[model samples]
Target: MIAAPLREKKRYGWFDAALRALLEETDAALEAGVDVPEEPGGWWHQYVCPTHGTELRFDPREREATAFRCPHGCVLEGEAYRGAWLVFKHQERARTALSAAAMYAATGEAKYAEAANAILEAYASRYPRYPVHPDAQPWMLKGRAFHQALTEAIWATTILRAFLLLRDEGALQVDAAASDVFFAMVSSSMTEYRRILIEERDEPANNYTAWLNACLACYYAVRDDRDGMETLVSARGGLRHHLEIGVLPDQLEFEGSLYYHVFVLRAYFIAAEMAERLGFDATAWTGSAGQSFRGMLEALVGLAAPNGELPALHDGPYSRPPYAREIAEVFEIGYARYGDARFAPILREAYRRADGGCGGGTGSAERRGLEAVLYGEGDWPAAEPLREPSRLYASAGFAVLRHADNPLSLLADFGPHGGSHGHDDKLNVVLMHRNGFVLPERGMVPYGSELRRRWFARTPSHNAVSVGGRTQAPHTGVCLRFDAEARRSYAWLRSEGAYAGATLDRHLWVDRDVALDWFEVRLDLEETVDYWLHFAEPLNVGGGWTACTPDAAPGEDEAYGYVATSARWTAEEPFAAVAATCGGERVTASLLAVPGGELYRIASPGTSVDPSRPLDGLLYRARGRRATFVAAFAAGDAPIRLARGDEGSVLVAPAGGGGTAMRFRMTEHGLHRE
Candidate 1:
């Protein structure tokens, strides 16, 4: 029953492989004295399923006579179990094959060896060949197209491990016919994949499809096929383009959400592994796929809060957050490949941070919830999550603190740009550091017209200039042109004397600028000056939200609000309000209003209120009016300034006497004729 030995190694031995490594761990556990039933008539065992938490039974006694039964049918075997299939999938089969082989060699059990051969034979017979298509072809209805490619690659690599173990055990089953057929299938698949990818290599967005191409290279290299390796190496152009377009230092997703970023990084990491195995370094092609992997992990760490939850995005699962368990997996891979030990501490800290966190107690913890995984060890045994906090988002805020490299001087804006995964949020900045904690985008994940309005066109979702006091027309259920909300005519992140500048052009109507220097997060906004403003109104001598400020003690600047009013007039001018909502139930808001057919407006402070109104608390707007206002905040103790300066140095006080002044130029519309 011993499998045939196959392939030669370059620098690594068969024992160093992933499958072999896991097997070694299991073997060590067994040797540490977990009672194992002897071969042939070995006894079965029962335990709770690790994934579904259902009762499970497994018989290691019989090679082909093992049985497993669970009430949920979340057994380790069978096609009817999607949940089970996802858990102990093809990857597990590969690992199990090596483990069985190693156990057989150590115990000299015909049963273990037979078990190894059976698994190998079963996979070979089932897949036989890897598919070349990116997805299931139109006619291939029974199974997925990409599944065959990914699964077969797993089978081939693991079978190679099986053969290697068999050879070392001196139980070589060298069936020349079988070996040739397997090799031919792998080699032919590589050829087919390479040709298809090459023909469509011009398209950059189709980068994920290259994962199959990389796997194809691995299979070919295992067969010592050089031509196929060359083809695989040549197919990296499109992938490189995809990674670059995803993010830039200056222009980022408004909200610091990184859902799609994970998939892109994974694609590159898998390719790098393939490149390394084939005697080719992918650093040049990938421009440090390893570093990119590190960057992503670091970002995840930064994204984690003290309590271990990532910032809440529209759809959570598309991009998973990090904790000890995930960090361990990343570090293990990094340690194996790059020989970097720095990742060790990061992993250890992630575990420490996630061990004891508060949970929602809905017991939905294992539903692939990103928040659960962020602050706590989640369901993984190797983790130690932090103590759970009361609110998940607050916990998420704490989780992000764990990864803050520059907690004091850094800035993070919660702006989801381009509406990835149908989350329509832009210009919303969640700035951290010593100024104000500004939560740009308010709540309401799904309360709009269509899918487009729900995603890309909701007013509460964006932090940009609004006209007629409304969000731009909804995204028309399309990617490229979502009603052209914010054309982003020009945007640049520049280093000022002490801070940086974030400015944008929303066509001709608005010129929005955010200056981040020392001690303040200043926003200089110039709107069309024609629409109705709800919050701050009636242009005054100074930019002062007077009605809301005198009695309140500014605690922490976390969030803010902007609205236009048509119902009342403090000094005979329509107004818009900008209020800063802090963590300590103190809300400091200002009302700035522009009158009908007036270019200049007056500003007064809106009344400070309790934190009962969550930033997701309410949506208050005028019934019928057109206005634009912005809400920006930062972390730390710096002042949050919302000043309107003109061409001259005359600072007209909004409240007639004690308003702050801007040292720059200015312009004036009309006087406050109240």
Candidate 2:
């Protein structure tokens, strides 16, 4: 069997950076000493500020101290904060142990080995005494070191990696008895985690199950247990089963979040690497539907924006892009495994974007962390900017339309309601322009926060239509038509069950500088319909508007309760415009006024988990059995005029009065443009 690359120290850019960081972290741990709490740690999600719903600030130097402070100068104490701090300590210990093991392997230092062994022995000695957490939900599998079995699996994987490095380096030979105890404890923990996964986790395809399988695979590899490995592979919800069912035909994760897609793929990569090091043919493994790791990597490559960021769809962190090192490491592994040239540009771009593209700085140090040290091949090919065209991932339920020359792109979600992590936002649209999100999708807050369910996941928080002030029911949407050309692109989608008795259809047209939208809803009964849109910048309405009382606001239930200040206007003419200035660029939207349409400009929560930074929102409401909304969005202040055209078609042209008018007709077959 080939030795793992992590066992050898290499001379490369990323390697040097990783080694430096590891040494600093290990030295810090050595100075601070190890601290294992008698009580189990709390759930990590509970570490957020209660008032703001943001994460509490944790300084590692103050790990021994108890008081935790939020970013806004609020201090929190008691069991929740203390328990959460303990969890952070455990995580730091696991990471330090791995770093010390690697440092010992590279430098043959006795001090590093001692530090690593101390952490392992401490955990092993206390493993049996730590009680299962009391706060676990009925559906959750309780853990000893952490609140959930999922976290235990994560913590154990790091510890096992550290142990494997020490064992392979022969450092464990000095303390044979302690080594045996550690091994036994880890083996027992793996067994319990596996049992929990098989019996308790009904969804083998979940991201949590992925981590559990990774832990089991790592342990089996360490023991050279072929039978154990086979059992895990063939189990009902094991690695292979997850690949077959959890990966969609489009090769994206079934959860519909890029974050989880990369997350689950990381677990699979870890398990496969372990299997390969153990002389197992894991690289050749594929799902029944030919779902290979290469396909998954290719899907990410295609979905990445020109700047190498992905759209934060569904329940994901809206503000955070893929870490420079994280994505660089992913593509490094991809290039090594598949030798795909397409992976090269992404790697180069990630590195270039790291720390403001500075050659030597903290950013560069971060970009050159553990993944790059272990997987990267030193030099990367030069990056050529991506000239990506529009794409449609049909099976995964997403469509992207891009302008040829600029960074303007539109993403439409008309796919399966992602299970539990999914939001009530089918047929929602997000617009990305000039390297920023103009029409943003407020991804989600922490699951522990009530705002996650109350505001972030509701239909009104997204750029979609809601019925009678209620969130849309979970439903899948289908793409009716998609056509792309050099000058124009068009897509239409239909959702029948987003509302119980209504069917929603949305059509979009994209050109060099503008996007046109036509949304129509047919209902069984007369009900109020609201077309919702949220902007990244404050919106300023022009022409025919007046102040209104708070009672005149849209719906007050569901997410609407969060809407603070509002203004209302009745459009007497056929056209109304609202505009916002973003990064010195003007973004304008022109709407075709309905007979009794009431337009509103309001301040609401933006794409941030923090409620303090609110964004501008536009709500267009009309009451009828059938409602239609037509609008045009552009980068500059060219207001668009809309009117009825020949044969019930819609006519749209720049209100500035120079461009030729375009006609759009929607039919059962598709949308036609002339």
Candidate 3:
């Protein structure tokens, strides 16, 4: 039998060792005397660029000291040099380096040209010496450190693009002195990235870090680094091994988090892209590169709410990126390559939803879908145009959009249970309508370490089952270990048309049932735990007063209980049971109900909200073993059973057998076979 590949034996020493040495030498030089001269009028800096930390010595005295060298020796002029390196200081720094270099070439000013050259030279000089940071040691476990890593990666990509721009535009008019350094920098950077992949492959603790490393490797591979490409592929294989070993594929059971799913898609997307670039023939992979691309895109599209946002869980310090922008690019690229445009609209909607790019309007689901297709319903072109909002975070949502044509709705969960950016939303499914959304994910926002840990990462922020009487594990105060079972979600279009909708079934455990409605939902979580479903939107009650139990306390971890209020009070039915409970140890199951004036009071939140939305319903909590509550709704004379359960208490509303509306709440012991 063949033995597993050994890490030490892998080959990259020839180039990697040299790169590390050069980078160290450059770092010392920059620390020693490399300084950006203080200009009188404009901003010149002796400070380091917080992101990549390239040294800068900018001098305004252009005539005598026509050039200022970074440690790597690429020279730069006064203002342009400042713009080239410091992105946080100015927006122009975000532009491609090639563009910045062009500005200098056009002016024929030695200082400006040198400023650009300095950036390239600095990188080049250390290129052969820069070692991979990941291989040095373990990264800090704190969320802030991980966050910093994320930022650095983003900044580095932009800098790389600038270099590409310079090279593409023929703006590197300097002698080999500068050119050699620039090439070395590129090579060194690639080698460092290779090291990251190697480490991730050897030991991947965090899926996000793994994916980020894979993305770096893909970038290098596309730049024609064969070693880098293979390393990433090998890392991917290692990740898969861990998953297969630690996780159950058939039924994904996550404690509560969506971070892993997001990163998994990211790794796949980058790997697929890089593979295609290397002429590996993406078709060999399951469903082809186009399929993989479309699968991820559609996944993002389907994950989005009607309002084009995701849920409150798993959201943190990282700003949400534009989903549509990425879908558009990937879909267009795949379409051009494979001649398939079926999922093109998936990309379009992602853009439209994320960036308001559909052109027609906002909040119109139909229009968004139509706009996406209409825009891309054109003939194939050699190369499509690229637009703004290309950030990776923004593109994260495109995973769903890319998977538009996939037969199954994918669901995954894995990641840390606590700490920053943790969302107690494990085993969640990115559901799909026959065509669009069902219970769309609420988009994330900037991370607030304190707030996130306190509330955002809690149980009520996701779609899952609550155990005992709480959303989290009683012992650990985190989520419990519950596996997903018999996962399946796929639908076909019917004559009812685009708005008719489709059915999705993401079964958990053995035979749990989860059903959805236009404005309300009914889930018989027999095999699961006490159900706790969260709505990103607030509930609107039209009648009685609102109320709840074990409600919000000062600074306590939000426990389970009932919190509800009346929507309307018309003399006949005045008091509203905001939320109520019946059976269990003190309070186990809790029910939260809302009335829509229609028959389905316990239905899922509707896709269409009034142009002017109303305040959402009160949150319900339970701490015991069982609970129940009944909400009333005017169903236009229809006697509808919103929901019913056997083990726990069931809320029941009777509108006088057809009296327009009815009322309900928990029964005696919590049995509601009625």
Candidate closest to the true structure, highest lDDT: 2
Runs with alpha carbons beyond 4 Å of true place in candidate 1: 1-118, 129-194, 197-201, 235-260, 286-423, 431-674
lDDT for model 3: 0.32
TM-scores for all candidates? 0.46, 0.89, 0.49
For candidate 2, the TM-score is 0.89
Give per-model CA RMSD.
14.7, 3.8, 16.0
**Per-candidate count of clashing residue pairs (backbone under 3 Å):** 101, 0, 115
What overall lDDT goes with each candidate model?
Answer: 0.33, 0.74, 0.32
lDDT by residue (406-514, candidate 3, tens digit) is 2112222322342344555443333322323323343332231122334335554344433333444421111112222233121110111101121111221111122
Selected candidate, larger lDDT, 1 vs 3 = 1
Model 2 C-alpha lDDT versus the unseen true structure: 0.74
Residue range 2-119, candidate 1, lDDT tens digits: 2122112112232223234334444443332212112111101112333332334332322232335643565455322332233233444555566666666545677557666666
Give the per-residue lDDT digits (tens) of candidate 2, residues 243-352. Answer: 88889888889988876787788778877876766667776778877787888888876666554555568887664323454566567788777777677666655665
Candidate 3 runs further than 4 Å off = 1-150, 161-202, 205-279, 282-295, 298-342, 353-422, 426-443, 463-471, 474-538, 546-615, 621-624, 628-674
